[model samples]
Target: MFLPEAWGRGYATEACTAVLDWFAGALPGEPVVLYTQSANTSSMRLSAKLGFTELERFEAWGAEQWFGVWSPLTLSG
Candidate 1:
């Protein structure tokens, strides 16, 4: 997790992209799941930028949670 001061920077995006790339290479055709609270717009946006597709929304911990899936097969050149 990034600190408040680290928000808005590309650190998270860059780091996540690298990790996803490695994951895809290490496990071809595997899918990953992402979970974030609906209140966190930044995370939601990041997930989208990372190519995660919305799976569903559910109430948890008294707040709406977002669930998304990311599959290496969905990656495009």
Candidate 2:
């Protein structure tokens, strides 16, 4: 999802929400993971809005902090 110019427009949320719904139905009773930098407050908020729960926080790629495993419950179709 590379919308460089579409930042802060809710485009990412819209696109991700659709994908999440499809994936949830495609794989039922499983966990979906979404990872991003801890510094990216917008992404964190978006993930939360999409019902992704935090699993861990760690450092990676030299001085870059990351939040891992925004776990969302998969739905059965």
Candidate 3:
């Protein structure tokens, strides 16, 4: 979902949350992983908002990459 015009409108966050929620339900006890460039602040913020915790950081493709994980238990409490 790449929409420059839709940036900062909360659309990405909302859509991602809905998708993650549905996926959690469809596959209980499974974890979801996301990788994004560390320089992308918006993505980092969204990942945190979606209950993703940083698993590691590494240099990749000539840039820093952030690896995160999310799980139903972590999000639900």
Taking every candidate in turn, the Cα RMSD to the unseen true structure, in Å, is 2.6, 4.0, 2.5
Q: List the residue pairs that clash in candidate 2.
A: none
When 2 and 3 are scored with lDDT, the better candidate is 3
- Greater lDDT among 1 and 3 belongs to 1
- Per-residue lDDT of 49 in model 2: 76
Models ranked on lDDT:
1, 3, 2
| Candidate 3 structure lDDT | 0.92
On the 0 to 100 scale, the lDDT of residue 41 in model 1 is: 97
Error of 1 at 5 (Å): 6.5
Work out the TM-score per prediction: 0.89, 0.70, 0.88
Over 1-77, each residue of candidate 2 has an lDDT whose tens digit, in order, gives: 65678777888788887987777678755677776888888877888777776777777876456554533443222
Misplaced by over 4 Å in model 1 are 1-7
Output the number of the lDDT-best candidate.
1
Residues 1-77, model 3: lDDT tens digits = 66798778988898999999899899998999999999999999999889999999999999999999999987764
Clash number for each model: 0, 0, 0
Q: lDDT of all predictions, in order shown?
A: 0.94, 0.70, 0.92
Evaluation by TM-score, superior candidate among 2 and 3: 3
